[model samples]
Target chain A: MDILPQLILNSIIAGAIYTMIALGFNLIYGTVKFFDLGYGALTAVGGYSVFYFYKTLGINIYASIILGAIIAGIIGFIVYKLVYTPLRTRKSSGMVMLVASLGVLTAAQAIIAIIFTSQFQTLSINAGTERVFTIFGGVITQTQLITLVLGLGIMIVMALVFKFSLFGKAIKAIGDDEEVSKIVGINTNKIIGWVFFIGSAIGGLAGILIGFDTGIEPTMGLSLLLKGVIASIIGGIGNVYGGVLGAFLLAFIENFGIWKISGEWKDAIAFGVLILFLLFRPQGILRR
Target chain B: MTKTAKGILWVIALVIVVLIIVNVSSKGGKNSNTASSTPIKIGFTGPLTGDVANIGQNAKAAVEIAVGEINSAGGINGRQIEMVYEDDRCAGPEGVKAANKLINVDNVTAILGSVCSPATLSFAPIAEKAQTPVLSYCSTAPKISESGDYIFRDVPSDLFQAGFAAKYTYNTLGKRKVAIINVNNDWGLGLKKAFSDAFKALGGQVVLEDGDDPTSKDLRTQMAKVKSSGADLLYFAGFPDGTVAGLKEAKTLKLTQTIFGADAWDDNKIWDSLGSSADGVMYTRVGTNSSDAFKTKMKEKLGNDSIVYCSNYAYDGLKILADAIKTAGTDRTAVKNALYSIKHVNGVSSSLIEFDANGDPKEANYVIDIIKNGKAEIVK
Candidate 1:
């Protein structure tokens, strides 16, 4: 079709956004081994931080974005220390952790709504001045380009860090067996906490970019989280690189699947692929 | 006592207290038509809490103001009007529950409410079967016109508004090829269908059509598809959040097509968020003929200067029902009949409001609002 370039571009943009989410989500799941539903809400946390700092308080845009990500990371760390650490210490079931994360998500969203009033807000100061770029006859905005570059950049950096760094190997060791890692003096809890920080920071960055691209509301987190979760699962849960591959794959399938169908079926197509993966290829495209 | 025994006793106590309160509250509102001529009971339903709670609460305040004025004026035929407010949460099942409570428990003679279309439509069948005159203030779905003989709304349906937009887009804007993208919900779907039908009738081609889940903010795919279609105009339908997301997506896609929106786009929140991206975007909104006095009264009641136009319609809806009750007494059928023959009652919503044979406002008037610099001004 004459629209192939645009469709492909759309898929890649969607993929880039989802890739950021899936990366953090997969990273956290690797060590903690429980679905951190609250991780989703941190994206809104990051986006709103930028809104408050840059748009509301007149801070530098770059500084606000960095502060937004760091704030999300700190909050993620705090939640780990406060809610999840206690539960893990008590040896709670995965279901209990999942439910707790859900509570965290609900409470965080409510608190945000209380503070900011649930209004969708944009992070960009001047909407009309956005730079546009054309690649292979497909139009892409500056924000989307940044998102794509940053998403791939982050993935590569994370992959290298995991492969070559001592901290990465330690995290992998903990993921393999927390008890064994602790016995070997790798500080499982501390490493897991760092992973949470990194993962949540990435999630928040996704939210910040999304706020600039579209807009942000308190409830935007759950949907973003669901997409990331799907990407992680289908790409092989707990596998960092697999999540990245899964993110792009999911985006491509979602955009291209709806090419001949109605756009409303995008979510259905996403969940359908998730179910298919859960059924036939449970380990996904890669194994951890 | 043992822990289990204590838990069971607490549960039993709670159940008894709940039942007692329910029984007493039920008795307080019903069967009070004794020889003393008790206050006329009227039920009001709107979402006091939910996504559209702001609109619902605004309408509630307006209705309360109307009630205060009517009571100060010695009530309807010397019988003081008593209102029972129920929160439907702007949902279908909740609407049915609220309507049931109003009809069966509260025993209201008439209902002036339900700011949402789904809520209005959900309870219309019950209101019809029970012969309870239901006058909606903000519900604008076309299906409401055929809801029931007893059902009436002050606001004109999306059909007329859609027709207006279609004619304007085609003949006025001179757009022959249009793109349609709407939130996948009753309000969006209804407007999209009506607009498409009207545009097609005017010999306009719908070059691209798409619907996104109402909960989704990402309209990139839809925007991309519409962009490739090279349409001259895009008629986007969504609530505040969805509308903001859709318009922003269109901007990100760098689509050069003129953007048009439906009544839901009247929300200032959308414009506030979209900022400069909202510039040149046009939408249809019902023009209100509210007076300075009503504006002052609303400000006094709400402690704010902001006024959504639906609140004006709600105020008028209550006033119209009160007038009907004054003539027809508390009889539901008589109130319904009186409403149908309302002639030309002047109120805040409009200068002249008369119900036609189909229990709709005879005249449908809408104006185009164009946004620039994050504020909307009526262009036509």
Candidate 2:
């Protein structure tokens, strides 16, 4: 019953979740070069969509997850087309885009609150019969285990795509320089649109998993987004592999920091690390 | 100018001037001397829209039922009781505004409401300044005991609950080392302090203590610390959302210590979602022994079988206010005096309530309940 094993297990579970969010956020930030606050709302949208399909409409849970991810992807695409794309055409500043994204986040959260009545909802259908597995003196539920596996699988696939896929090359070109990518016949708009969909779909998967692991709330998105943003920044923003590394590091730091202190200091410890990084190593642990 | 035309215009203007003066005077007179048979206005403030809206709305429904029963029986002193409800949204600023509106605009003699402790604390000063008696049905922060002489609540503060829980854990359950994890809020902090004080007084050691933001969903880090503390029991103080998440995480970590909680865990929604995971968890709640007749009435009214404990307190709060008005008339000061001295008031919580020097219930019967098969059963 060494507590170290349990603490490590908890850190890994949290790190897995943060990795999913940070990867998607880093991918989008690399190309867009702007903070999409609306990304948080999409997390809620993904969870609620599955809740509607599986719980309300009686669809199969696995199928509902696919549909929910697709719906989130489409919504992300629509937001780009309607808001960001138009703003880009108008030559708006990044600040303007950030503000617009905030507006979208607020409106989306309000809509979800109205529809879901601001009540905490669990997405599990078999919460009562769910089984627990012990590993190295630490316990984990099935959903958490799946979360770890999903995080690893996604990271491997993303790394391979970045290395080999033509679509990935197009994305990198655009991220390097959008104007030059267009002149080089990279079809920047189409490639960026695809990036948004894929990134948002990954974010949606994270949301769905979170809903199963804990529960869903309208305001859950903002906190999740904050953690992801922190991970991306500390991991070297826009660096895909670095984002994953930063996520696990943050998870470990936060969990261990509270090992001998009050849990109320958890958030303070996170921001303290962020501030330290900004002050001493502005380039983060892994500089691009 | 023609003489007849000027004369007619002057007469019409005079008539209009006289009508305005009469109307203004009558409006002022009506407010000063409200008719005896007119409805006695009572203002209610609670969260009808935000996070804790469920509790607020439930309390409102129960109070309305009590109002209906009172009015049908020809209300106190042959006057009907009318309730004006304001949505505080469970925030401090919102509660302040609601209290002002209820006092200044609505001109109510008494106010019932504000389920959340922060909201109640925010509005208590305003009610005291206005000399309006405010009875909170659910707010249980220990600070409320000394908030104001005019501020009252039917529900006992967390002091009683914490003391009960501490004794139960130390004596009945025979757990010596205890760890505490609480949400950082008025309710949580109050219980945390009270329980810690009581536990230490009973010669039990507090091994570790921590606080979490109410909005935080993850408690694994805190659970890890709790597990390592070598504590035989864990006392978690939080509302339903945080509690459910914390419990799930503890179960995942296989923290086998007994978990103790406050009344916030009385929520059925949490138990239903938790399923078998909630089994064997114990919590202390104000014993609500509502009659079958009341349950049937609440079911027919709310379209549900379950009525939260706060709703019963709210129902009793209205009855107590009416009884006070009957005994001391509608004058705010007289009603306050009567409330301060009110004795042996029968409430649905299976307790006879009498205000102490500080306006809290002098004594409350706290019952320990254990969850079994997704239902909370009172431990005998």
Candidate 3:
């Protein structure tokens, strides 16, 4: 049976989630020039917030998702103020900021563990009523199609905003040279704060989408962050369009690479591609 | 040096001081002990921090409850069993240090724990050389027993649990084609191998095999492949973190199938992370909600507010060890012999617990659990 079409569809969906994380990570990394390890924690925040509101508090899932994204935006602003801003003022090295981010990751993970108590949970929306359709010898779920559409829509909107909006131009100017942008009266700090809020909202949306698609756990952020980082690095660090391209490329390679081997070798193939990129074009595909 | 570095150095110094005091006091106490009156001290080690800490803390609580119960029932041959707990940080080197401290400094007669198989493997040789009996409740690696007679595991190895889950996936869930995703670790590898063997033996077709580092973030690549594999089911083997994340991504990508796993998928942490996406996650684990003994004992032990599965197993493990000691009449050798001789002993989770020559429990049932509303309920 030819499952190529189904596989392509699935890869596109997976690529969408990766693009969400990559977009946020790339935005932050490009402008700040420091790894925001805490972005992963925000993903957890987004997932758990929706989980708590919908599953625990009995709120509607759609409402919970909006509430979760808003909360993540708030958290992103606070994290920028508390951690990144102070580090920036200190003229901290990238390594120092990286370490601080790791600390935030550890502390955030510990807090999650303390609150949720480390059990696997599921959203109960389609507990037993999922419908699957077979096309071209492969099966696809309705929920997956929705996620793919949502992801593509969000990416398109983000790309449009980046190309057209005044806020997006300010963000780009800040990324190019924070001092120069500040000299030009850009209010770089406030613009950066807004960037975090918007970027984290995207991350939260990714988290919510992931929750609907898979499941949520306290430690889910780490793997999500790794994928985002890989996607960003592969496509072009700090390049908005690059993340989407990178995610799709990564998905296609991984999906098709395991045709002759056990699927277990899929990751090795992905990492091998990553290594090749690292060795040949350390600047990444788009070379921002 | 930087302020943070200076602070870290001070903390390290303080920890060293505390360790020195503990070591010196333990040495003095051992010397002061009258040869005939020395209590049989036992050391228990595992993570007391981080995500899996709940597993260790519950195990520790169970040990405490069981120790108190056995001591009240009159010590193993009138010799009080004393437990000394340590945090292994779930790492190999820390686990070895914990074992050394227990053996050389505390002079514990036997040691329990060092949860998570990697840590357990590190402490195995140290315990064996010290001639201390080490019974692990958390380590599930099949090779843990190969460290020799000194090592005993209360929980059935992943071999049995993973195989059973794979069989259930094929015969019960009706999954013909499956994809295997495992973490890069002993626990993950062992379970994957076991599942592969059992699934193939049952005539199930495995379409793909994928490995992910438990700590990595981007799983979309591997997940996308699984989605496109045309498989009927997905099997993830790892701690709850990776399993939950992978499952959630699979859901996002619209990869629909029955997801199966081993005991690591049993934690509530997975639910906290996965949220709504966690529904329908299937895994095999020691039954958490089946037997009356576990429920009743847990209620009596932790009250209704804190009943956990690991605690019940730990409590049962302690009871079993104490029973063997009592049945053997005070000698450690006799206790070991009696443990082997026993054909059937009721456990907190089982109606009958019997060990074979390899010390593997016979008729051991790994209950299949389906996640419902963030909790795992026994399905098969």
| The candidate that achieves the highest DockQ relative to the unseen native structure | 1
Residue-pair clashes per candidate: 0, 0, 42
Write model 1 residue lDDT over B270-372, tens digit each, in one string: 7776687779999998878888999998999889877788898999999999889878888889899999888546788988888987788988789999997
Model 2: lDDT equals 0.87
Full candidate order by lDDT, most accurate first: 1, 2, 3
| Candidate 3 lDDT, A1-288, residue by residue in tens | 345665676567667778888887887887778889888988888888988999889998779989999998899889889998999999999899999999887788778767876544555464324566666655556656666677667778877877899887888889899999999999989988988898888788777777766666677788788778888889988888787788878877876776555555666877888889889988788877
lDDT per residue as tens, model 2, A34-148 = 9998998888889999999998999999999999999888888899889899999898999999999999889999999999878788899756456788888877788989988
Model 1 misplacement above 4 A: B1-3, B17-54, B77-109, B126-132, B299-306, B329-334, B356-358
Candidate 1's displacement at residue A226, Å, is 0.8
Of candidate 1 chain B, the 10-residue stretch with the lowest lDDT total is B28-37
| Per-prediction TM-score | 0.91, 0.90, 0.78
TM-score of chain A of 3: 0.94
User: Which residues of candidate 2, in runs, are more than 4 Å off?
Assistant: B1-39, B74-80, B89-94, B100-107, B325-334
TM-score of candidate 2 versus the correct structure, residues matched by position: 0.90
Q: Look at candidate 2 and tell me the lDDT of residue A12.
A: 91
The lDDT values for all models are 0.88, 0.87, 0.74
Residue-level lDDT tens digits of model 3 in B1-380: 99999999999999999989977766656643234455666678887764467678767877887788778877777778888899886667888988899877776666778678888889888887766777777778877767667777777788888788877888877889988888877777888888888899999988888887655443555666776678989898867656655665566556677777778766766665555566787788876323565556556755553455556566766777776766765444565667676643556655566556655556555677787776667784
Going through the candidates in order, the fraction of native interface contacts each one reproduces equals: 0.50, 0.62, 0.22
